[model samples]
Target: MICFFLFTGCEQVSKSIKDTFQPKVDTIAVEKQQIPDPVPYDAAVERQIEDAQRLVETVLEKHTKAHVQYIEGKNTDFLTNEKKLNRAEEALKKLPQYLGKEIFIYSSIHFYNEGKIRVMLQHPQNPEYIDNYVYENETWSDPEQLSVKDNIRSRLISLQKISFTNVAKAASVYNEKIKQIEGAEPITGIYISVWDNNLRWSPASINGSRERYSIELNQNGTLKKFERE
Candidate 1:
């Protein structure tokens, strides 16, 4: 009877151990099954993202450092501060567009001028759309919309010289003018384009119901004309 009780007790303990360990084995198997395959990394896509991140960081650093300089009394020019603020705001506007977007280099064209290149980029998951970006003197301009037939490389080479800030200023002026018009919403984005020897600025409101307005800037960045459409 003693041996019988001892054997029964041992059997119960063994069963308990098995019961405790069985679930763990099952859980490990399930976890192994749930493991996902590694995603393939694309070097071109990675390079594009890194470039955009670097651009954002560079702009932010410029803004922050300018303020730091002012606070430390290294510079006292109020106009400079104002200009910096405007540039910073412009740069900040671009930040949201790049967030959560996949960017890839679509194409690149070298200009006759040394150190100048027109780079086309595909971004925002829209395979049909491409953007034109100008790179010169180690600086990159904000992207402009590029259509398949734009021939941006030749256009850039022939277009009259104009500062990007001038284009931005013209857009800002139009934005303010639109705000005073009845039923017009705030301008959320402005795209610059050169066609037919004319510089065009299109500012559209974030509100879907509002229509985009077009403004023409002269070669010198003067507001030549504007129209609602």
Candidate 2:
């Protein structure tokens, strides 16, 4: 027994009708998005080397720890002419053309060891890079960088010491003696090591036809010992 004329009854009935006929809206839950942080900068990538140039030059001039090796029956014209080999020479000849006026420091200069590749890291003005000059098909390719080793960091050397000049001189001084041995293959390798301010160079034949000899020189470049091994 409800009366439609009553306000409450009319309002309730209207609400009921609306609920029956009205369209429903659905709600969905959303998740918040998160963005990752970028990688940190490495200071070692730009770390500069120090405290070796002058000392290295002095060492080079001494020829104490330097080595000069000739391949079996190979020409050594490049050593005698003192042709463009050092960083300064490279800077003067190739860098100005390839890298402009910015100077490139040598990050990988060392004594000429046997079986070592003689390539320069070509990333101009950046010693931190590990890429070396690559030549192929009579054309020079661009440098490619690699991960620098943790233990063996870059060691700076002199710019003007004509790469392996002292070594060549040392070789010449001992070449006469090494070649003097009768009926033996010519020296195929020269190894020089310095210790206690003394220099010892061993010119090895390694061909089994001749014995290897170790020759030591004083700091003043005088012969100290010569022994057959």
Candidate 3:
């Protein structure tokens, strides 16, 4: 009987050791089976991509010429001046590859005073791609890779509002003071110009003369400088 008991205890200890040392086999092979194979490149898609690239390049060249003409003071028609830019934007938007992509082309004439403009094309979905060009001094700069900020137009509108409001308030006070003087005119309107990230407001008087008020506004629409002429 003692031998049998010892034998039973040894058997239980061996079972426990084996259980502890045994490697667990994963029963769920679904994940391994679900791994997808790499997608093969399609010739049709490659052809489309090549066509789109050529279209974009052509549009960019045309846009550069139009901008150069404007900066050289040869084209004063606002609609004619923006025709190439509009065409470029339309062509880019129509590209199938650009669909559902965070692709944008932003053109701004206010970046420089000599009628110069900057065009920035960004594909945030593909960080490796960017095309930025500046047209100044009758030439287009080399393409540059630069990150484009979102909501640029909205920010500019906000800055314009802040600049106009401050200038209008100052002009009102000046008008009131001049009203006490004989035959003095009040400010009738304000024109806002944006250059070098600064807002300039020119207050127009009833007599047709104007004085400029230069202001700098922060990104959050706070006033950095409020100088009135």
Best by TM-score: 2
Colliding residue pairs in candidate 1: none
Provide the TM-score for each candidate, comma-separated.
Answer: 0.32, 0.39, 0.26
Error of 1 at 200 (Å): 2.3
lDDT of 3 by residue, 205-224 (tens): 22223444444434322344
TM-score of 1: 0.32
Candidate closer to the true structure by TM-score (higher is better), 1 or 2: 2
| Poorest 10 consecutive residues by lDDT, candidate 1 | 108-117
lDDT of 3: 0.44
Model 3 Cα shift for residue 65 (angstroms): 16
Model 1 regions lying over 4 Å from their true place: 1-154, 158-160, 196-198, 204-214, 227-229
Q: Tell me how many residue pairs clash in candidate 1.
A: 0
Error of 1 at 53 (Å): 26
* Model 1 score (lDDT): 0.46
Order the numbered candidates by lDDT, best leading: 1, 3, 2
* Residue pairs with clashing backbones, model 2: none
